[model samples]
Target: MIKTASKRYINNFKGFSREIWILAIVTLINRAGTMVLPFLSKYLKEDLHFSLGEVGWIMVSFGCGSMLGSWLGGKLADKVGFYKIMIFSLFTSGLMFFGLQYITSFWGLCFGMFAIMTVADMFRPAMFVSVGAYATPETRTRAMTLIRLAVNLGFGLGPAVGGLIIMAIGYKGLFWVDGATCITAIVIFWIMVKEKTKSPYIDKKHPDEILTHSVLHDKPFWIFLFTCFATAMIFFQLFTTLPLYHHDQFGLTEFQTGLFMTTNGVMIFFLEMPLVSVFERKNVHKVKIILAGSILMAVAFFVLMLDFWIGSLIISLLLLTVGEMFAFPFSNAFAIGRAPKGHEGRYMALYTMSFSLAHITSSKIGMEIIDRFGYRANWLFMGILGIIAALAALYLYNFLHREPKKT
Candidate 1:
């Protein structure tokens, strides 16, 4: 019995051993460098004295560029190696970070943000592809959970550190610090992270194989994509609408809102893997878990709309974090599971694109709704959409789990 237990422990370690650590480190470094978004609007508004409208435009430009970048990166990863694409992305993004110091006008800020988001987004698909490649079916979910943990931990620490740095030196100091960290990550990737063998779906003789088979050729994949896109629209709203809700309704300060966001990252950092283990052992279907999480998330959003007394915002955030912990990593694993072996980069790229599309759509739509109807009305709309997405996810999960016919 002891020998059997020892062997089981060894197998578990072997599942994640070194490659996962390398990927985790890369995630940490990237997140640490890019965690200044919480303070970015403040810097633009107060330091540079940009109007709120101008800042909004700048953000839209970055999102547009990111959408283009994610698509291009996926295509490039299929042609060039994932490692090469990641290296190029990191270096270029680092350069863009350094260039932020020179932005004087609205156009200059827009251009700088565009360049930075484009290059930064390029690293995303490649990183997802690399993780898919490194992990096996049995361990892939846990591996992704670990990656999420690393990301949340990095994000949690990074903003706190960046906040302090901005308080001390200023926004320029934050930009320089982020730029230096990006360069450091690039160096680390160069020295330590090694690419494994390419997927069988990719052709060694002809790299153009990826372009030949369109992602739309698969029907189920499209269904999954739509589900992701819808869900993300609701998910991304948290960043924009939630804080405003708390501020207007509860009179919470920006610092308090930041604390609420940090709590999300903290929960994921500590609980994601354990949650994964628990859910996986339940023999529950992956899609059911996803559906449940989505419903919970939507409910959490709806709960926030209630005119509760003080501290209710914190409770709502906790509920949303719990739901997010289940949904996000599951989405990653499910997408990877559905991917054709060679087209991992393309699949993951498409998945990430859902996020970009959602952010763009949500910001535009949510803002317009907020303009017409107050924050409460806008959130009600989002909550309704979230419910629709949950129902759709459940239907898709059922469809995907249906039995295949014998030859």
Candidate 2:
């Protein structure tokens, strides 16, 4: 039984195909590079002597650039190939990372952030489009689940490793390390992955098909997109409000905080694929999973309001991880499943935009609430919003599950 299980696991990874593995490796490396961001605000405030609001604005700039890049990446993926676009984005973003060390003024730093985010966002739609191209419908969700697992694993290791790097050499060392990783990822992708076929959205004879596949006209797609936006708002707040609450209310050290963040990724690494497979076989409704995730996430935040206790925080992390395991993969699967055939690039791009939009909006809202009412109020508000997101997911699922009108 042990040998059989090990064989099955090996086959599953091999079955993802070489292209999928390449993309997964690239994702892991790129995510590892982004480890700088979690500590970026602190780096700016202490090492660079920037104000809190200025730091927030710099983050907003990055978010805006990412949104714009994702919007454009879809079109580029359809027009050019995903591999080419991704390689270019990775290399350019690497250069931008190293360039940050040279920027002196606040505006220059903002521009650097914007440029880096734009290049980073370029990877999202291209990667999603490649996933769609690589996997059959039967394996698509599982493939994406594996990819998410890779991302989380990278997330788990990147910051912890980055923390050590920062302690040894400072923020400049962080940028240099990320840049080197990005360059290595680019070379690996260029050598190992080849674009095998044109995007389904783009026809060789009928070039006009590209112009016609607009996702905006699909009502059901828009419903799913809105749900994505709502959930993402709650999700992004985890990085911002959750950590601040832990620090201000509970007084956790940076190491303790890192552990709190790492717990989410660890859960994803262990539980994501098994959960996906279990749900794949059951008669369980996808929307219910999403709702359950939202409720658990909200409950986790609400639990934080309890008096400072290490046990509570650990429990809360477990709850949040459960919520993430349910919501994120299912949401990605549902979006790709519902997309109009041949428009996966466009659909996934819009789906990814929800995250960028959520980050921008949540940061602003969180900052305002944190400034006025305090961390508890901010977390409570996010928890309430998460519940609303749950309702939205239910509404969307029912709407999609309904019968279509006869032509």
Q: List the residue pairs that clash in candidate 2.
A: none
Lowest summed lDDT window (length 10), candidate 1:
203-212
TM-score against native, each model = 0.88, 0.88
Tens digits of per-residue lDDT for model 1, 1-407: 99985665344334584877888887898787785676888888898899999988988888988987898788787778688888899887887788887777999889888878888898888877777667765677788888887777787778889988987987888878888888888788788867665743233342212222457685656766776787778777778877777787888898988788877877776567777877776856666777777777778777767766665576667777887877788888877666654677787889899989998898789878988987778778877877877788777776665635100
For the record, the alpha-carbon RMSD of candidate 1 to the native fold, in angstroms, is 4.6
For candidate 2, write residues 228-252 as lDDT tens digits: 7876787777777777767777788
Per-candidate RMSD, Å? 4.6, 4.0
Candidate 1 local lDDT, residue 321:
82
TM-score of 2: 0.88
Q: lDDT scores for all predictions?
A: 0.76, 0.76
Off by over 4 Å in 2: 1-14, 199-213, 283-285, 308-311, 403-407
